[model samples]
Target: MKWEHALKDYKLYLKIERGLSNNSITSYGLDVEKLIGYLEDKHISVSPLNISKETIQQYIYELAKTVNVRTQSRMISGLRSFFNYLIFEDYRVDNPLELIESPKIGRKLPDTLSLDDINRLIAAIDLSKAEGERNRAMLETLYSCGLRVSELTNLKISDLFFDEGFIKVTGKGDKQRFVPIVQSTQKYITCYKNEVRNHLSIQKGHEDTLFLNRRGKQLTRAMIFTIIKQLAVKINLDKTISPHTFRHSFATHLLENGADLRTIQLMLGHESITTTEIYVHVDKSHLKSVLQTFHPRK
Candidate 1:
């Protein structure tokens, strides 16, 4: 089969079978596309079904020179998953990446913001501007609910369950979870909706969307990143941060405050408890306190 045809089928399997998000599918597709590009550049005619391990190794060798170890490792993983899909479909006998070893990279802990830092960042928003209240609400929701940026953007007006003190969030792979919402956050969101969002001439499909741009369209992921970056600059924050920083902070802060891993895992909508364990590493002091309080030796 042609590379393009194989790629199209692979993407369909990712969406329908694996239930990956669009961004995830696109990322996986890009890995295969990069291999295709490499073959074309070298004038090597090889289809996905018949591509040899040597060709893939050569591609990896070339790729390692351009990307960092982490990126190279991720690309290899993506390609491996694609080939595994082919095997699952009975299109291939074995994956070309079966013997390929990924680089050994240390687990990089996520960066977290201190409560004071978070407060300063939020305080820096220009409240006089029309988007100020919206920005405040967005940041509060991000931290309070431990939401992914995409979840925040795709949040709908109907998702708010203030009477029950939870907001329904659609996480990765479209998995839905109800996260508890603090009354303060609820108030901010309500104020923004009643004041600013109500005033917006919302576009046709975006009326249900929680956050909208000045044009009344759904806010893009890039826009959320831009908003956080701008706020960091306004506060003169030294560390580089993104919207995910708030999530990391949310998890870390909860762990520090004696919240259990299982509880935090549920709140963050993590599919694996292992994913939530990273926060334990984020706050060693919390662990020390726990040991001091509970250990018989203490």
Candidate 2:
């Protein structure tokens, strides 16, 4: 099969069968595309199924020269998953990546903002521009709901169950969950909707979208990042923060305030409790507080 055809089918499989997000499918496809480009550059003609393991190893070697160790490890992992999918679909008899190894990288800790820092960031918004109202609401929703940037961009007006105090979030793999929205956050979002969004000329297919650009189109993930970066600079915060940092801080603060990890996991749309458990490490002092408050001997 042609490279394009293979990629298309693989993308469909990832979306429909594996239930991966669009961003994840694109990342997996890019890994395969890198291989195709390398073969073309070397004047070697080989299909995905026909490429030798040595070719992949050489590609990794070349990538190692330019990219950092973490990127090399991710590239290797992405390629490994692609080859495994081919084996699963019976397109290949065996997986060549089985013998290959990924480079070792240290586990990275999630960055979190303090409540004061978060307030400072939000306070920095100009609020003079029309989009400022929407940006404030977006950042509030992100931190309050612990939403991934993708989830924030795709959030719908219809998803808000204000009377019920919850918003329905469609997470990775189209998994749906109800996250509780605080009254304060609800007020900000409603203000944005009534004051800002109501006046915009929303585009077709985006009428239901909660956040919109000046063009009235749904906001992109990059736009969300850009907004956060600009806010960080305005506040002169030292931490290299991103939209995901708000999410981590949401979980971290919840844990620090004695909220249950399982509950936090559900709200964050984590598939496993273990993923939420990592927030516990952010504040070890919380453990001492828990023991002192709850222990019968104390």
Task: Count clashing residue pairs per candidate.
Answer: 0, 0
lDDT of 2: 0.90
Give all TM-scores, in the order shown.
0.98, 0.95
Tens-place lDDT digits, model 2, residues 82-177: 878788889888777889889888767799999999999999999999988999999999999999999999999999999999999999888999
RMSD for all candidates, in order, please. 0.9, 1.7
The 10-residue segment of model 2 with minimum total lDDT is: 1-10
Q: TM-score of model 1 relative to the true fold?
A: 0.98
lDDT of 1 by residue, 1-298 (tens): 9999999999999999989899889999999899999999999998889999999999999999999999999999999999998999999999999999999898889999999999999999998988999999999999999999999999999999999999999999999999999999999999999999999999999989999999999999999999999989988899999999999999999888889999999999999999999888889999899999999999
Residue 203 C-alpha lDDT in model 2: 99
Clashing pairs in 1: none
C-alpha lDDT (0 to 100) for residue 290 of candidate 1:
92
